[model samples]
Target: METMTTSHSLRSTSINPANLIELELLSQIVTQKQSANDIRGSIPYLAKMAQIIDNQRLETTVAASSPQQQQLQQQQHTLRLLQADAHRQLGQAYMKIGQYIQAEASLTITIQRLESLLKDDNAATSHSIIVNQLIEGYDLLKECFELLGKPHMVQGMENRKRKYTTPAPAPTQATASKDKSSP
Candidate 1:
């Protein structure tokens, strides 16, 4: 039932997250989840939740598999690290109760990043301290997000892959034909 809305890359045409068929399938699932008789759910809220669910499911699926999934997964790790630090500081706001989730999220992100780097061919790419920190954070965030049912973060990232992966447009044959005739 899960269809990928990921855009088609001619290089990797099957991987696009902007896929329409994926959206339609996800839409159907969301519609089925909430029946017509549910009086308390607002239309706007339903729409938002539907988006979140579709996004989360997509995110989880991509995170679990795909070689291309690595790029976005790295970004998520970085984000989770930052979030964990914020949670740590906030934990200071109330010393009695341990901010376990926050700290755990941060550590988790760090470990995940490390594992990713080890597994990656590009592990040699040097990064700044800030980037490193963020990578660690993403690990933590993934855990927290999973617990909170916020898996859509990964899907949101897939949406961004288009910006980084899509190649520049090549000129048409007519343009090439014109260029050859010039001067």
Candidate 2:
């Protein structure tokens, strides 16, 4: 009975299909079966998964989807978070093969997704985590631009890092007094 219960729990916690695909894609890259010239084979599949997850979320928001087909709320959130991470990994794969342009594009998409998430109301509790991801994305992206010999492109990423990670300065005493008097 104990062994049967353990097996049932393991089966219930099986990996997601989309995540399984993503893991296989990453393995291909790691094993050198996928290269810059042929990343097309993997990217489109991952992109489709991301799109499906996104559309599923939208569907749930506007109307009831069949509960049998619907992803759980926690699953949806986890998948959305992984979407950004997968792109970042893809960008690294591109970088490894010296495909700077593709690397830049993939990392930029990752940064954009991370930034968008930061704007969500629920992101408050995870602000530091998101900011760290953004910083890492920007750093990798800057490396891509540098390798591509576009020093100018890196500057923009640097600025974004500063903007995202730096806190605004506190008001000085003079400014605080002026605001107090005006009100």
Candidate 3:
């Protein structure tokens, strides 16, 4: 389709066109189709977006510490998040279309990507967002396993989902009393 070139003030700097308006439009279309309950219709768009984002490359001439470089890094992070989301959406669409095999594959990819992003201490995206996405991926995968008649896989996926959703244990009463005395 149509491609738009990004204008960069730096002498040698550019982000892949696929990572810009085109991807955004595709994402919006996918969102619309999903909201309209046309999950099958959204599948192609989500898949296309995922493919495009995965192939994108960010080019920049600025120093690593420069603001321009920081901006580019942020864009890269955002693109990664979008890529994970696209897969997640694709999985959901496949599930709605009764394609459990495809759903499992896509959700697995989504979960791996989110988990990798979560491990990055410098990820610009919020931890909660990544965690929530991971939880959603696990939930979808669990459903996929159930549909595929894989009860063992379902229990494992449920445990993984709980890992993200369960709150950390509260401080012990002894620890709390010790802190009170110290202060």
User: Where does the lowest 10-residue lDDT sum fall in candidate 3?
Assistant: 9-18
Arrange candidates, best lDDT first: 3, 2, 1
Indicate which candidate wins on TM-score. 3
For model 3, what is the alpha-carbon lDDT of residue 150? 99
TM-score against native, each model: 0.23, 0.63, 0.74
**Model 1: per-residue Cα lDDT over 123-183, one tens digit each:** 3453334445444445444444455556695454344334334666899999999999999
Answer with 1 or 3, whichever has the higher lDDT: 3
**Candidate 1, position 64, lDDT:** 52
Candidate number achieving the greatest lDDT relative to the actual structure = 3
Off by over 4 Å in 3: 1-15, 18-21, 24-38, 60-63, 66-69, 121-125, 173-183
Q: Which window of ten consecutive residues has the lowest lDDT sum in model 1?
A: 88-97
Against the reference, the lDDT scores of all candidates come to: 0.43, 0.69, 0.81
